[model samples]
Target: MNDVTTDHADPRTVRLLVALYPARYRAAHGEDICATFAEATAGRPRSAVLRECRDLATHALRLRLRIGPTDPAGRVLAGAAPVALALAAGCAGYFLLPQLRELVHRIRYPYPGLGLGHAVLDATLQTAYTVPWLLALGIAALGRWRSARIAGGAAALLSVGVLALTGLYPYTAGQMATMALVGALVLLAPAGLVDVTRRGRWEMVGLALAVALPMIAVDRYGAQHLLLPVLALLPIWLSAVAAPALLGRLSGGRPDRLRAAGVGLGALPWLMPLAAVAAFDRPARLHTLLQYAGACVAPLGAAVAVAGAVHLARRVRTTDPADPA
Candidate 1:
């Protein structure tokens, strides 16, 4: 057995790896971990040391995201998973529904302005936006972390493809990229959260339906053709308004600021299709776009402000030490 305190060992790198462990775990096993890491990497080539660090980082992430997650940051990411999934699916559905309605009516491209090439582009856009994210979330819930990461990576790339397909509108493209970002976050989440229950899947599906069907209903039943954009987005508007208060109630106190922030972050992707509808999506109306945009921004803005305030206070408490009773 080689001595771990060898001079060739990179003590600083080893210490940083050890610090990635959960606080309690670090307190109990940190020295042993550092010793083992040091012993393994002493006099090793840079590439080998880098590989070792990567493996250790994965293990640390698993510990944080595993059943009964203990790390606060880990808990926040895991808690945010369901919320992100819902938002992503809802946005995808909102965009995909009109196309689906047209297909059902046997009108692939009713307008002379929308060519077959454009129809194919729209289908590809929806597939790229939606499928990989669903795959990433489902695979993670099933405890297949490697596959989840692959799916998440694919989701991110496909989302970029969706942006390119959109012809590069910065505001809408940035909004569209939110699912990619959410997918990236889930790439690190634990396997089999909530024992791999079906709850999360059903919730996402339900929200997607909730967002899409209402618009179709209003158009078909109430004869509110001009209000389709607003109807399509109304559920999201309500969610933005309701989520902060709902998170506060569920938290039973000072509000889960991190979770609220996550929900607000999740809401952003909806703006992509909303902007598209206002600017170019069929039934594009100048009249309601302002209302649509404001509905998207206001509640999310308030939630972000609160989250920022909480973060600033915590930073002050931690870094200032000026508290006086």
Candidate 2:
């Protein structure tokens, strides 16, 4: 009789493969699977070990989504933080920095003009500033939580330093604070709280596009015209209201009243710009419109954030089993 011993299979490798399963599944059957694999493949070909490892990974992913559930609040925060942080970085680098540089040059040179050198430098700086956040997002998508946290933290710190050094703090303190909050959420959230699944990646992409497309359109088509900027930003305002509701529905969790209310309140930031535009006569230039819009949105964003915190607290209280009934 031919023996099927797995002498060729490394025990350490077998254990590592078993660890790929979900936490619950590993706790339940990890040791048994490891032992069985070690015994059954004692003299088997290396191909058998590879096949088993592949199967383990597939099953692990399926079980992660099916059995090992995650908190909806955590999932939403985790999914949203990266997109918000990336947007913050991109805006600071691509939109704010060049303008600040031009202002400095105007003061120093007494005249300023767009030149090939300046354009190249601007593009280079923009790319440099944007790359770290992109890398962090990519790492987060792969479920490399630790790496993502490190990358995000580094990027946030870099942004803070740049803003402080350039004397742009007065203009961007609110944005910096928002970036800090997003960084903290990414770095401090518990393991498995952030779902790095394919669905999670798509959600991030959708949110990013929701924010980005309008900004791009405004910059390209509306920045030089009055009323056009307002029109372009209208989609962003609409998205702010729609995104949370859509995300909540797709999260696959039971609907909670507080969460819904929080999401509704969170949309207030987008509404504030529209309200400001309505209250005042149309601005003469694009910059004035943007300035007023930003001023209106920042305070409202804070209020909505507070509401979101209250919602999170309520969710925690409801989910906690040890609390007194």
Give the per-residue lDDT digits (tens) of candidate 2, residues 1-325.
2344346567677767777777887999987887777676666766776777765664565456542225454445444444454444334333443366664564455535755566555545554455677677667667676688788877767655554544543235544554565565555443455545787566555544555566656666667775545544543454453455434543434544433333333333333334444445445654765665664455335545555666677788888899476
Report every candidate's CA lDDT.
Answer: 0.60, 0.54
- Tell me each candidate's TM-score: 0.53, 0.46
Clash count, predicted structure 2: 7
Best by lDDT: 1
Residue 193, candidate 1: Cα error in Å is 6.0
lDDT of 2 at 18: 75
Top-TM-score structure, candidate number: 1
RMSD to native for every prediction?
Answer: 11.2, 13.8
Distance from true location, Cα of 316 in model 1, Å: 33
For candidate 2, the TM-score is: 0.46
